[model samples]
Target chain A: MSSLLNIIVVGLLLGGIYGLVSMGLNLIFGVIRIVNFAQGELVMLGMYGAYVCYLFIGLDPYLSIFIVVPALFLFGVIMQRFILQPLQNEPMMQIFATFGLLLLLQNVVLAVTRGQGYTAPSKLSEFVISVGPLNISVVRLVALVAVTAAALFLSWFVKNTMAGKAIRAVTQDRRAARLMGINVELAFMLTFGAGAALAGLAGTLLAPIYTMSPQIGGNFIMAAFAVVVLGGLGSVWGAYIGGFIIGLIEAFAGYYLDPALKTAIWFLVFIGVLIVKPGGLFGIAGAEEVGLREQN
Target chain B: MSKTDTMSGVTSTRDEGGAVPPGITTFNTELLRIAGIAVALLAVTWVYSGDPFILNIMAQTFLFAAVSLSWNIIGGFGGQFSLGHGVFFAIGAYTTANLYINWQISPWLALIPAAILAALVAVAVSWPTFRLRGPFFSIATIALNEVAFVLANYFGSITGGPRGLTIPFKAGLENMIFTSRFHSVLLMLGFLVVCLIVCAWVFRSRLGYYLQALHLDEDAARATGIRVLQVKLVGMAISAALTGIGGALFAMYLRFIDPPTLLSLPDIGVKFALIALIGGVGTLYGPLAGALLIVPLESQLRAGLSASVPGANLIVLGAILILFALFMKKGIVGLVMQLWDRFGRKSQ
Candidate 1:
């Protein structure tokens, strides 16, 4: 019973992080329709960016988030304009182009950093709160709160903001949006930047708990992918819910099964979900209908 | 006036109508392709025989090429970009290793069953994962590879775990051992030849058309009676089988199999996918071209940096992948084909 409770608690907390990371991926895939294979890499970069600031300037990683988020946003914008824009029309081209970008960025980080691993020095890592039999880490609780806040903010922004509407419009139908005088290209670029920035923020938040390394993103990317798929394609709520589900699964798996096989176990669940429900748990039903119908 | 003449600079005017250009016939195209293959075979064989070091490199290159060509069948030809090709490669290597060690089976005989098992696994993976498209498919593959690696590690007791298994060296045809590097080179060359021939046949057959159509537009292909699911399954099976064969050969060549070397992401599946991508995926000869350039370059780079720099190969390889992706999307073969076409036009 205690182990079950522990698993649920850790799972929910970790789910927030997964949700946080996957939200960006889902956002980008929803609006831009490009799977940023480098999404996790970008997260790794953000964590590294925070780590650099911490190492060089002695700034707290959580505080450095203020600086890292905007910088990553601009980096995302630059990548979108230069690398992703040209391949927008062809899905295969996008796959290869982003994959190329993944290879480039991952190697660059590995080369520059010499593949060093580091830990973030932050208050969150130290803070904790106890309630009866449940001893909760304050930092994780804070993360959960922050993630929920971010998800809510994103939902509100997409629902109310003019830019958000335009982004949504473009995602639904690029030709129709263009015909209606929407600058579809700008939306794509903006969405990509925003998505990347979101990933950066998640990385910053996560740095306190996790160690940073060039290969860190590889693990995160797979988990994020599973979360995104389980949540359903292009559904923000799905990402949030799916993230928690995976986190719980991982927490339990790590405790019961061998730690080495935790990832494999979760990935097996991911494959199962994909096989059972290709649309994902929260994905908008019939979203792919639009694209498939036009092709035929 | 003709599209072919305009593109190739061959004249189709009345002055030339009396005698058809020898180059324009279907027979000529086949002959040219055959001639190119023959020349490449001769050159590689010559290199294999002339220099012991070159023979070793040639053997490795052919092995890499064979893997890349196998990857291209599903990834490039069928348009399913799998980031986790290591699963099939690992399956092949491990199956052969277990069969040979535990069951006392010869590597030659082990390959057939290994490939069949790999194909079944590939099909099982496809049945579940093929429903995913775009990045989802790629990510699923990566996940699948991870699962395979973990499982390979989990069954450590049976698989020999991280310590790996060593095949006893018994030099004979039955043992699949070679006394000289030349023999290994010849063996690998045979594998390459078979893979290339299969690729070429697929490129010309009805399956090729179905694959191309699926790549272009899956829904449209399905609507046009392409049977996208059937074609994809077949492509995956073939890809896995070839990869399995490559793995079996790899085990035989190394005379040992460790989980890290055999099942690791870098050595088997990912390497093949990267090579295929770098060589002009989907093009018939692209994987061969990629293998020739990358394998030699990697070897040279490794030798050059062995003393001064430890991980220079990673940097160079990453740089080349980036450059290739950005500037040479079609790869070396694509560029060569373009240049050849231009020169052919000028001469005509």
Candidate 2:
């Protein structure tokens, strides 16, 4: 009973991390409609940003979140304006350009740091609280609270805020939104910036939870893709549910089956889901056909 | 075979309903110029540049040219944009490598079956994936490739797992393992020739027109009685099969087979697509240009940067790629064509 409880708690915490990592990706992709292949590299940049603050400025990793989020938002804005916006319609350009950014961000980081990695011990992770037979780390609890709050905040912002409404409006119908006096370009730029900020925020928290490596982004990005696809293409809450489910699967697989095959197991499930539910579980049905099928 | 006469007639026709242009003759001249460049490249190999390292790079370029040429069929012409081309490459390499290792079958014989298997796999995957359009299609393929990689990693008994497999040393044309650099380069050159011929033949056929039509608009093509799924399947099948053969050759060249080396998204998959993109997708000679430029540049950068910063070379390449993606949307061939068009208009 205790072991089962332990798996559930641990799995939930892991799920929160996955959810946080991918929620921004969903937002960027939903509105911007570019896959942002370099999304993982943005997370890597954020972790490095926080790590630098800790190493040089004496800021705690968690505390550096304030700096990381805004800086990354600006970086994302610049990227969108300069790189992504210029070639929006050409999918090849968008795909390869983001891919170029992925290569650039990762390699530039690797070159600058010369592959040196940072690991900061967190006080929160050190504290352990027992819930009946299960002992959970405080850091995991903190992460769960942070991401859940972020999700709720995002949901509310989407429904209530003017900027959020504009973003949603543009996504639904760009030309219609433009006629309604919304700055469609600004919305795209802002959506990308916000998405970057969210990814960066996730990285800052993750840095303390895991060791910082140049390739950490690459490893975790797969899980994020799996979660996003499993949950729904563009839905926020769907990503959360999907993340939790994947985390549970990973935890149970690690304990029950070969731990080495955990990633493979989830990926198999992902492929199966993609084949069976072409529109995803919560995805707007027949979304892929909307833009392409209209002209014909 | 039947397409030769029709291709000759249509070759002079310009784009989109074949509007005859003042620069029609200039376009034919451009095609000749491209042919001349290919001939020159092949001629250079005859000088027998004795530098072992240069020979290795030269041979490697041929492999890349073949892989990218094949990729262009599906990705460039068919507009599928698969990021999982390496999955097929790995399938090919592993099939041949495993057969050679376990059964002692000659790689030359194993190549055909490996290619056929890869084609079948591509067809199977593309059946459901054809429903997806744009980035969603790419994401699905990437996930599937990742699944294959992870499974390959876990299955130690079958795949040699994460430790990877190495081929035992054997020499001679029979084994497809050569003792001389000259022989390796010669084999690769032949492979490149075959790939070029195949690509040229494809562009001259009705299949090419169907692929082009499908890429521009799928529903419209379907309405026009083009089998949208069939053309894409054929394109992917040919692409994967050729890539598989190239993989086998690459493994034989290095005499090693590993997931990171063959299956890595960056090294094989992206590089395959990158070569096509860099040269100019949909252009016959674009992959050749890409391979020629990238193979040498990457090698030089690796040699230069490995001492100090590990990834500085890749950073430079990445920046260049981004610049190309932004500014030079069509690549070197596109730029050249634009210049030629300007000259033709001025002369007329």
Cα shift from native, residue A273, model 1 (Å): 2.3
Model 2 Cα lDDT, one tens digit per residue, B104-223: 999999999889989999999889887789887887777767777887888777668888889888997888998888889889888887787677666656787788788898888999
For candidate 1, list the clashing residue pairs, or say none.
none
Candidate 1 residue lDDT tens string, A35-106: 787898899888988898898998898899899999999999998998878766656556666665666677
- Return model 1's CA RMSD, one decimal: 5.1
Model 2's lDDT to the true fold?
0.80
Q: Per-residue alpha-carbon lDDT of model 2 for A39-129, expressed as tens digits?
A: 8888888888888888888788889989999999999999999999987777777888998898889988887777887776555657888
Cα error of candidate 2 at position A104, Å: 0.7
TM-score of 1: 0.91
Off by over 4 Å in 1: A288-296, B1-39, B48-53, B306-311
lDDT at B300, model 1: 77
DockQ of each candidate relative to the true complex: 0.44, 0.70
Please provide TM-scores, in order, for all candidate models, with all chains considered together: 0.91, 0.93
Residue A172 lDDT, candidate 2, scale 0-100: 76
